[model samples]
Target: MEKEHRAYKSHCLVLPYPSQGHINPLFQFSKLLDHKQIKVTLVTTRFTSKTMHRGSSGIELEAISDGYDEGGIDQAESIQAYIESFWKVGPETLAELLEKLSSSGCPVNCIVYDSVMPWALDVAKKFGIVGAAFFTQSCVVDSIYYHVNKGLLNLPLTDSEISLPGMPPLEPLDLPSFVYDFGSYPAFFEVVIGQFSTVDKADWVFCNTFYELEEQVVDWMAKFWPLRTIGPTIPSKYLDNQLDDDKDYGVDLFRSNNDACMKWLNEHPKNSVAYISFGSFAQLGLEEMEELAWGLRRSKSKFLWVVRESETAKVPKGFIEETAEKGLVVSWCCQLEVLAHEAVGCFITHCGWNSTLESLCLGVPLVAMPQWTDQSTNAKYIRDVWKIGVKAQPDEKGIVRREEVEHCISEIMEGERGKEIQKNAMKWKDLARKAVIQGGSSDKNIDEFIATLVKR
Candidate 1:
């Protein structure tokens, strides 16, 4: 049912970069604000609004054009072209949205824009309202980008190791792929680095991480920006359950097979199945997929894997049917529900921030198979700092061979080391819950954000 419209002390327009990973956190944060009686309007591109599966969360939804009203990035000539077009068109549409809202007696008081699109803050400023930059990545990752943006970290890094403020020394392999490989996905590298362009001007900077989880980097960032940590932005049901109706993230770019996945998990024993997924965007080459498939077979452990429909053809012929008695493979499944299931032993993941946070929040150990971008860094933390998982090492060909994949899975799903990792995972899970529950670190930061909006 649609929620009743009611008067609120402040109206905040939440804009996320148009992607499943980017949209989910911002939407979850919007739900929290709505629960606090802050009027929240979530804005998506016309294309995304048309394609997304909208849940009945009832936060007001609005749409602005990203220039391709029919199809978003897929319609563009290139990533660079798409980004340039969106940059030019996004601000104009956003200003129009502001003008429309103002004339309707519901003027926006703030715009919490995805940091990737710094132009949104410019629109917020043009309308004379508070602008908050919301970063959907970890603080350590953001700090790396901020340094690169400021020229503190030089590209084509000459050193084997990097030492930065409030972060542990990192090997070149441990840095984000954009930084380590430089010029790979140039457009996306620009987007990540460009986030700092107008960030100093934003009234507040919010990161989707709890303070306790990233205390050092968060503290370092706070010194330079009005930074606040308010996340692990999954549904409240997975965290604190403070928002009664908060279950799934209210939007998804793809449909999931919840019933089939849950049924498969129900048939497995506790902590017996390895849950494998490469997230929405990462695509494994056919050879890698074959290796992963064979590795699952060789591990002899029951497993559940999510292979996006586009990538399903790459799966080895007859692999699914051959492994049918021991495994289930689907295009997509409700991730949180699968992670929360007692049968899911360890996650073999791409280590995307959203997936990492989900596994961490749900107390699932990991076998990190990092593909690119921030996944490597997250995997580093998963193995080193967090001690809740093991990172799979790839060979010189840059493929995690079946042997290594099988080894990592075994390491996490069996033996004394697995027990320690499971213990650490549960400890972080409790901390995650505490951070989002009443009077906790993330909850307090959110309260401060709302309080500031009301005062403004």
Candidate 2:
């Protein structure tokens, strides 16, 4: 009887939209479930499994076909083509994987799927299992998308300011790029808005944010959906240190020069280095890159910048050699480790949701240089709502000038405003830690999820 019970333990399969940012939070959440003695399997596409720099996540990994076994999204003709193919093929393979797991004696009882791929929940329903929608963005951003999906917020801004429940008035620019710059990337816009298509049917709606961070929005959304805030879903060491060996996200799609970056940071003075990265997918134009390069040079602050290998040429000619004494430019470094270092005083970022949350959780002030998508909205919060950073304003040409970049960096690093921003950053950091530690808001929510799953 004991053996049979152990063999039939409740299991959850976590499915993330195939990207580093999407995978990391879901994987961290899977680790949380695994730590609670729940059997967890992380689902990746066959292509991503082949491409990623696999790390020791200490959990089982399984692959499903995204209809592009050979090359994934890059092989697809366009974003729409890729999404359509995945939607058609994902359900069939997912059902097959479920059957395979069931015959293997570890039947999956639940699926925690990326909200963007809502069809996964339909598969879970077909299998008579619980389906949890895992949203990998801020509640405010999700709420905005939800509103747009429900036709509450019409497109092509005619209004000077927009009002939404549980959020302050937002300007046209403060809205997500998908909404503000309507039709810019219609396929991606569809993917974002389509998240709400079947979300009402999910057994649980999980947002990767803590209650303290977005209490008002979370509460408002909870009234309509079974919304739960269970995140900052970063590794435990940086926040509460509750989970053993939870230092890094444990999986990377890109390589990092860990030793070199750490060594350079170690040599810098405490709270002196400005750590700059634009996450993995953002691409800046050559002119913008040139301006940014010179801007960092003008700031006269010691900096460490992650310029992806593809963008290396865009860095102004001789800029690397000229700034070598004060700045270290590398392809990539372990961002969490760099942010946690005492030498990293401020972050100059593209304001991607994951990067924004990481900076907020780690107590690092920011200079928000938003690129696109949900970034503009996040940057708005970072500068106005959170009071932890200042946004670098772009000119009418939608290019942030070198002088503006220097000013934003200076404001965070040396100006009187820097002191206030630093204080707010530390305050959010403590709150973030408290949310994930034992008996805290996010911890309790995770416990509730596990308890409900076990009961089912």
Question: Best candidate, TM-score-wise?
Answer: 1
TM-score of 2: 0.98
* TM-score, model 1 to reference: 0.99
**1-456, model 2: which lDDT tens digit per residue?**
332344334799999999998999999999898888888989999999998886676688899998999999999998899999999999999999999998876689999999999999999999999999999999999999999998899997789999999999999999999999999999999999999999999999999999998999999999999999999999988888888888998889999889999999999888899999999999999888988998999996899999999899899889999999999999998999999999998999999888988899999999999999999999999999999999998888888899998898888889999999999999999999999999999999999989988897
Badly placed stretches (over 4 Å) of model 2 are 1-9
Q: Cα deviation of 443 in candidate 1 (Å)?
A: 0.7
Task: At residue 451, give the lDDT of candidate 1.
Answer: 86
TM-score of each model, paired residue for residue: 0.99, 0.98
Spell out the clash pairs found in candidate 2: none
lDDT of 1 at 4: 62
C-alpha-based local distance difference test score of model 2: 0.92
Give stretches of model 1 more than 4 Å off.
Answer: none
